[model samples]
Target chain A: MTTVISPPESPAGSPAPRASRGFTFPTRFLPVIATIALFIAMFGVGSFRYEGFSSPQTLLSVLVDNSHLIVLAVGMTFVILTGGIDLSVGSVVALSTMIAAETLRAGWAAPLVIVTVLLTGSVLGLLMGLVIHYFEIQPFIVTLAGMFLARGLCYVISLESIPIKNETFTSFASGTIEIGDYFITPSVIVALVVLVIAAVVLHMTRFGRTVYAVGGSEQSALLMGLAVARTKVGVYVISGFCSALAGLLFSIYTLSGYNLGAVGMELDAIAAVVIGGTLLTGGSGLVLGSAVGVLVLGLIQSFISFDGTLSSWWTKITIGVLLLVFVLIQRLFTRRTT
Target chain B: MRDLGLRFVRHNLFWPTLALVLLLLLNLTKTPDFFSLRLQDGHLYGSLIDILRNSAPTLLIALGMTLVIATRGIDLSVGAVAAISGAVACTYMAGSPDESTAGRAVIGMTMAVAVAVLLGVWNGFLVSVLGIQPIIATLVLMTAGRGLAMLITDGQITTVNNSLFAKVSTGFVLGLPIAILIALAVFAITAVLTRRTALGMLIEAVGINPEASRLAGVRARTITWTVYVFVAFCAGIAGLMIASNTSAADANAAGLFIELDAILAVVIGGTSLAGGRFSLTGTLIGAMFIQTLATTIPTMGIPAETNYLFKAVVVIVVCLLQSPKARAVLSVRRSSPLLTKGSAA
Candidate 1:
């Protein structure tokens, strides 16, 4: 957050103190300010039109319905922070969901089913990381291939939608703890828990520091003796695990798995991560910022649905615009900070 | 002669050709008619020709993409640009239903190409002037360009009734399909433009080190902008060819994953993702390789639904071979045998 200004390399006749007085502001507070401004604008618009837009139930529902996406965005923030992207998350979600639903249909135990799904996602991510690291291939191409392979595997498992008949998933999905007239879904709790854990891991752990260091500069990180390849590979593995977890949550929420599910969800996650003030170039972002971004996007969708006139295509357009705006802001911020 | 043979063995073409041979040998074992060529309706038809025809659009796009990639920049909007061009051409042709054949077709083609060039210029301005990242800059158009295309056609597929338009894809010229001829023409133009001029040198220099090139007065910004615009224009031409082939312009589906296909072709053609080098001839071969693999999969009785998977595998393998480590291992394998024999003797 501290801005250290260097004196301009000019003749001594030029202004002295003024040259050193560069504009200084805290970087960490920018997202918070933007979040507050967006919240105020949304509240004002909702109050002007919708009757129950400010109601606790409506807000809770918005958060609950989009919790799975929020989880995906959280994971994507980590990957994007390291200046890498995971385009396979959407397909991985579908594949993982398919695996879980198929396991449940085959009468596998719920605990084992969950572990298998998570492991499958991690293994896939590990393979991608190994290929990318050992072979020195670009992450984009590797992940793109991952996208196709995962989606194809989903179809190979079953082209038809597989319904989850397990009572465990149903209960976890539908059951909610009530607080007077407002209720909190289990998925929302999971999303919040994951966000908190991610924040802790990113800010407090050695591996997190290595991740930031790697993204900041791979050469510098390597020179600093950081495990660059391991860190890079680890982040992707974490992303894969997070995607698998999101898939499990999605199946719980939907009670079915279809190969066609989550076809374009990776773009949404990328948009969310970008809008959260994360640099696509890598090395600076907050998991909590991504959570806020997911909420902002969810609110936009909620407002659009409330209006009842706008088509769903507007969602893609709005996200595109927001992505552009945030990217411009990040560019300006980086220019100033450096 | 010995030196020439060693040079040939060491060239990158040697390995790709070896791979191609292996693939062909594998295919011949399963399907004896895989290499059979025949003439039908005054046109040469065979698996090879079919692959070349099918890969025409991708080859054209990849030719442009190779230049863009050589500058260490990517244009994700190529697919969208193609879609927009298709929409413009189809919409214009549909609107001027009663106009003279030559006038309407010529006007429509010109308009489509102009629009694509304009869009490319816009992208170049953002990337080179505004100093935006190539991916983010192209993404803006990638998202909006599709909408603009849909808006032009009212989100409907427009089928063309123009014979001249269809000829671009279906007609034959001098015993060769017009599509193949167009592809060949594009390849020749690009090859001459890059190899016979200083333009290619300047592009490679700028890509290797932009700031250094600027210090050396290479006009890096202008070069970068020019390549993106050129790439977009090429994509536009490809769009027209695809739409003409299908005889229907479905803006949404016309070029959905073409960007990926183009990127794959460029990578397979031995271009480095990190920039500073390129190969137009290699891209042409790569395009044909992809098209042949795609066609062969279905022909060999594999389920059609697995095409995406098969394509993914091929791309992964090709990419792996291009990786620095893979090349290192290959060289080591070729040399280690000599070292072992010398020690044993």
Candidate 2:
């Protein structure tokens, strides 16, 4: 009868396989439904309370401002989908900015510097990946070491912020695409492209499904003759690459590479991914949800700033409460399915 | 007997102990008087004493974290709880007209500790009853905790002018810092509680394999629940000491990265993140090693900011050595007949 299954995708949290099931939930429907509803409800409240809140410009601005975070959440989604995590993203972003700023100042060509930064990121991810897979150290600890290494390397480069005044970088950051009365930054375009690419790879490609299968049951995936090692290691590489890109965008946005940039941003990315209906335990989630998650976070900040009288920390509280509610919902569905 | 010698070499405490000793020796090289203690105004003081005092909070948090890790769990909310307790205490004392009153100090501390205990219960309920990942569960509080703390102090840094309350961190008992005394008492009590009761074994069993332990009649849930509560309490107390040190509670920054330090200490002390076997002594050495390293860079004439760089190096070296693959290769080289001959020497 195709009753809800547990721990395996006989009814895995993916929305793909449950097309014909009418009696039960689309299964992935619960969390996804909850997230979308919450976003709408919050958006409605904002539009009702604050003037011009529902304007196209404010929505566009949300995407423009959080473009860096959007990219980060995408990377975090990949890692978490595999029941793994990458805590080094924030520090790597900081390192990226530092490297970009210093190299740009040293008269290096922007394109060459960009390639070097992304390559450096991939290499860092590769090293951590190799250590995790071969040495079998926990991803948490290894990424933590990566975090410390990246941050420490940032300090080694320079103890203070290095302003990015390079012509190409600044112009790119300043340039915006306009549509009628609304405008969006190049950073948002880049973030959306990355998101689209990630969604395709996760949904369409063999390697992508392998990620889900591996998360569903590594043993079964291995037994099915999948290249578990490469896929596992590759997810981290993707994360590292994304973090570096985010860093490049951040440098362009802030026009400087401060040593303390993006501190505790990993938590923010994680919170967004989780709140967007991505299962923390792996094997379930949507990339677009992570995008919405970032928007929700950005909206929370907007809500706080809009009120003016509201203390800034209230944003943190709302995020926390949302996290609590969504996480509980996740538990309910998982338990009932069991 | 020869096997026993190898066991000592393989002991989890071996590397951390050596690191601590070497760091101290390095400090000695810089200033011959580094270890020299003095009786100043009826209290002992020295670089060594300063380290003990500085690391007390980390050590206390690590002590609690050790138990939590032993149960296959982690508490990311410690930093937030630290900030919260400190905020609550400082806010209470600041609101009082007679801020210097010892009674007010006592009441504030009680309230702070009680609140901390409640937070721990919340963590316990989440982990035990809700079946959530410890990291994700505590992360909820970790994210909101500073906000709660800031809310308590009305989003302002709470500065209290209470001499009695400040004594919690600053006062001396038997010529030792009271903070260290409190940490040591907690450590001793934890040691006794774990080692002297069946509780320790139960915790290990659950950590090693929760399902198997459950099948074997262990209350794995209770163990997990209690450990989280305990760790939160420890973090809360650390917060109080931290606040007293500055006589102010900057909710956002008070215990900002201390959870990472405490977790790092626990990991460095040879407590595996995988959970199962744990060593409190290793945690002690780990905390000491970290505190010493933080000071060592400046003393060695290196920029103090590069401490993280050096720490990254040390963490990598330590983790590599502990990796099963690395150990397997080492054992293979040792047991090889030809390779063992002169190389083993």
Candidate 3:
């Protein structure tokens, strides 16, 4: 997370190490470690309690079930890394899902359906970015408006759930690549591929560095000659693409689209991102960490369901507790650093 | 005289007033009785009164929001805090019934206020002392506070059979809704406290330049912390009013999206999201404007679901108008010598 450490400053004449070696571990790594530990612990407990919990079916189901969320989180990570947010992602997902499902129902080719949904999402996000960056409006406000606009459009298209009657979508959704009794679903593979691509973009590119620089200090980044506006717009566009992709993936899984399908899913994505150690203040986070965060949340829900007594509300409660704890920890880490 | 009139037209208040007027005009075209007023049961009854009554919670929240935003901070937890407060207040009222139980209501309120205050302080501590981003800090509470509220009520809506509690929201004092009076009182108090003391100046200074404020020994941390606590308190009050109005504590639905509405009102009132300056009166007007729009839509036979869409459009327009670039453009247009040349020549 802090791999590109700032050059150390020496008060005295002595030169300091270019990268400080104290503790060596980045502060952001704490949440990532915690998430992994939690994932392992939950898996261990689930396997112990339920015979099939550790089986390939359970693993595939969990991954396939939450692939859409994973996609959304990947997109959210980019936007958050740029020190902005996209509250409209959930609404965008709904709108995109509706468009995709309707297109498929209308006998459009799968490629056309995909392209239309993605372009629509990107255009909406680009407009939002233009308004926010050019007009100097708050990202929260602009995205809030986007949320309403997208959701309204979804409603306008059809308030009722539009079922995907296309055989291609159903086949793709149910299709599995079997490998000696361990099957991998397409959605899971797609999510994994997206995660890898996102991680690479975030860690290895000049654009990634620019994102961090802008988030860390916009003024300093401007002074350092970073393309602040373009980077900002890029992040939102990436988020929009991710949301659109997630929407399409979700429609495949659910076989239907409705205006209220992903209501408050943005909150869940945000919670996962934070729990995964992505600082909302930006400048640092890991895509892998977010992937694990989504798994951890999925595991919590699975555990709750396994218990049979606890209602689904417990999921929200658990997430809330984790969010508060992570945030407080983030506060402490930031305090010690600055 | 014409030049002076033009300057007045270009004032900050001009846009909000014009927007309000335009909205009102639109309403008038749809509903001829938009301007009709009556006194019913010693209470002023009209669209204006309805606007004020409906706007009470939003006005209170936005009033608090203005201060927090003045410090260049946002409180996403206000809605959650309100939910928590409602849960606490109603749950306590359900547990007791005597006049002395009203004291329990007070205690419950106090406890809810304390919890809300602690949450705010926690947010303040992060933003001021720990340097955590305001959005992240408050988001923590925003997620957890609602769960805590649900947990407090055991994830169920608790119905209260308390008269005093109902009266707090439902009763009339001199024909005005008790909620309206409470809202007015809260507004008056916040206005006086902010304007009459060094709090407002310190808050603006901290928001404008925290480093400079700290260097000047302005106790930026304390000021930030105080405003958060104050904001949470206002949210708590709003919670009580809502719970009392329904006579039931709905942990799930109470004050849902209220934070967004409050933020909208604050923005519409011309408070910069980037912070430093705020207007309580402007926030009140902004809150009323939203309520008016909502009330007007249904009165004009627009479907209720369309309210969200309309509000989104209105909020976007308001945000655009208040944006720094838009303001800069407007200022340039107003100050450009072309108009002077066109007039003088």
Candidate 4:
């Protein structure tokens, strides 16, 4: 694990490095700024090209449509920042959705159902984190197993989609407040709260800083006397909790819990995170960037739908291309900075 | 006796082979006629034969995966590559004026495999040339390859009408399943190609320490690029087998989860995910074990949805059992006096 690039000792005196630095903004905010610009550009293009797109309602619709992704991206930000991954998040979301729907259907209270789903997600995450930390297995493998386990559990609960009939849950799901020409739902609000809290924690809190330290260099973090192990495990738990919350939101939005729900949503989240300018190799990302990333993807889907002739698969291709471009950009940025 | 048992358990191939054997024994106990093989029209027919036949696709992919992982890389796009290959072949055959001819099928397969090679080169370019992380690089294709497949098939499941194509998966040559024979042939070729040359050693050297190998004058980039291409070729063959088996190509579903299954096989076969040494024989047994488990799951009376749950549990158990910490804990009081300190945890 040698450091591929170390910071130059004399940044101010080198001509080639100076030229690149002059062409670029601060390296830390370069990706986030690029992401915001891309989102705005995409949204602007969609508004001008697509019919019925130039409205606040449509803007709100983007958030509404991608509420689950927003939450998942935030959670994924934490895991990726810790140099770990959680492929289980999507499956865990599906499992939580199934549990929420089933428990709600089984004559249970909304509070009880919510707690059970959240608890299930947290426990599963904690277990995977423990295996990854204590057993010294790779995060990818552990989370992969977790993904299978969660998906399998979803099927065990019910092979068919379970529709929510709980009155309170339905009301909460459908309840929205009109903000001028646009509207926002309870779920959107929840996602925003999670986003803000995540941003603050990541930027302002010791635990979040510790997560960055661990991802930056585990050995150094340990030598610096940071709680590397606990932070590593805790990030996973936070991810699990976020995934469950997202699952709850997805279930509410769809009002059904199918085992096959969110088949490749985890990939979508990862794609959004990368497009939003997070380095996949870990260390250095922003939560707000993930939110913007989700919007970019949502806007792409919206434009595709509006076109009427294009297939949904085009979104996948677009995301793939975006992922490639962003990764290359990150590479250039890191090379210049270091 | 104790020493023999210790050596056997400690062997890399032991657990995977033992797992395969135990699965077979489990099948035998449940059905009582599981191991009974009979000749049907000069071809073998039985559970044992079925395991070999069914595991061909997985075996091919895992064989390639063994090499890929051995180089400290992973190709998540193998499943997607399988889909694209199937789509290309099926679409080509369906459009052929004389779809029934073996010649048309051959051309279609060649074109399909050629596309797969191109795709593999794209992956290799991103990884070796551009220096993108292997997982992220392959992930680009993994995300978009299916879309490419769908485009090739015009968003439909393309079914070709060709006996020659069907024969690729179902037909037997010299009283052996064609699929099984193809897998073994590929295995034998790769075994000889790698073992008989410097390729295997070079791959291991690159996997162990790329910088060190480069400094030592080994052509690490060439080795990495070759393995990626080789892996894509294997996936292409597997795609042909899968499509030929069904006589149709479903872009959305063909080779779904094969990457995970292949990775699981490689791990179960005792190949370290961290790279360095690999074992083709171990991967063979590991693939067979998975196919057996796939066959055995339905008989357990569990719901279909919970099948993956069972697999997850078993995979976790196997991985944990193979983990250095778990092994140290288990063998602590027996042999090594410093076992307690050796466990990383």
Best by lDDT: 2
Q: How big is the positional error of residue B29 in model 1, measured in Å on the Cα after superposition?
A: 3.6
Q: Model 3, A248: alpha-carbon shift in Å?
A: 1.7
The clash count for each model shown is 0, 1, 0, 0
Among all windows of 10 consecutive residues in model 1 chain B, the one with the lowest summed lDDT is B12-21
Residue pairs clashing in model 3 are none
Instruction: Please write out the lDDT profile of model 1 over residues A40-140, one tens digit for every residue.
Output: 68867886798778787867887798898889998898888888889899999999899999999999999999999999999999998888888888888
Off by over 4 Å in 2: A1-25, B1-4, B333-345
- Tell me, by DockQ, which candidate is best: 4
**Whole-model lDDT values for every prediction:** 0.83, 0.89, 0.83, 0.89
Name the 10 consecutive residues with the lowest summed lDDT in model 2 chain B. Answer: B336-345
Off by over 4 Å in 1: A1-25, A46-52, A177-179, B1-3, B95-102, B329-345
Look at candidate 4 and tell me the lDDT of residue B89. Answer: 97
lDDT of 3 at B313: 93
Q: Which stretch of 10 consecutive residues in model 4 chain B shows the poorest summed lDDT?
A: B336-345
lDDT (Cα, tens digit) per residue for candidate 2, span A6-90: 5546555655554356744566556667777777888899999999888878778889889999999999998898888898999
Ordering by DockQ:
4, 2, 3, 1
TM-score of candidate 1 versus the correct structure, residues matched by position: 0.90
Scored against the true structure, residue B341 in model 4 reaches a CA lDDT of: 61
Alpha carbon deviation, residue A307, candidate 2 (Å): 1.4
For model 1, what is the error of residue B69's alpha carbon versus the real structure, in angstroms, after optimal superposition?
0.3
TM-score of chain B of each: 0.91, 0.95, 0.90, 0.95
DockQ (C-alpha based) per candidate is 0.49, 0.69, 0.52, 0.75
